[model samples]
Target: MTQPWKPDRGIRHAVIALGTCGVALVAAGAVLDSLWLLGLGTWCLIIAIGMELIYRP
Candidate 1:
């Protein structure tokens, strides 16, 4: 039998915060035309979303 999955509240909050920051960074990068910031933001977004998907019940 397989065990059910559960996510911690703190981790979920952190993920949400990370995703928000990522979106902000993406916008800032677009405004400033910075490729580095854009790439970093995209990475953060991907990681956060991936984690959420993996932990989803």
Candidate 2:
């Protein structure tokens, strides 16, 4: 039997959530003219990508 179709609860899930938030932050920054928000979002996305590359289950 198969269990589920979601990320395991922990590092991967957290990283994915961060990526999702990053997308939202980028959009909000664009609409609100906030450079800080854009930078934070970019960093979040970069971290997510790096984590995904390093983490393996």
Candidate 3:
């Protein structure tokens, strides 16, 4: 029997990647004392949240 197809996984992968990068950036920012990087990480985190909500399992 044919199985049901699934949606593309690229978005999910991007979300996960961005999430991990954001976490790493946050840690690096804390260690480096760079507000710009910290802000960038915060934005990345927001994007990750949006991506997750849009692509819920």
Candidate 4:
């Protein structure tokens, strides 16, 4: 017997989360005085790239 192939829900969720987080980080950066939010955005972007690479066939 063989297992059925399935779509990657984890990657999909990760992409959505990354997008939302990125937007929030950018908005916080603009509204706040610290650079931490901007840095967080950069990190989120990096994580997005990594997720893309992992999800790609």
Give one clash count per candidate, in the order shown.
Answer: 0, 0, 0, 0
The residue-by-residue lDDT of candidate 4 on 28-57, one tens digit each, is: 897896599988987897888788778865
Computed on alpha carbons, the lDDT of every model, listed in order, comes to: 0.88, 0.86, 0.87, 0.81
List candidate 1 stretches off by more than 4 Å.
1-7
Candidates 1 and 3, the one with greater TM-score: 3
Q: Which stretches of candidate 3 lie over 4 Å from their true place?
A: 1-5
User: What is the alpha-carbon lDDT of model 2 when measured against the actual structure?
Assistant: 0.86
TM-score of candidate 2 relative to the true fold: 0.77
What digit string (tens of lDDT, one per residue) describes model 1 on residues 6-41? 447767997899899999999999999999999999
- lDDT by residue (1-57, candidate 2, tens digit) is 876764555877888898999999999999999999999999999988888777743
Clashing pairs in 3: none
TM-score of 3: 0.81
Top model number, TM-score? 3
lDDT of 2 at 53: 79
What does candidate 1 score on TM?
0.80
lDDT of 1: 0.88
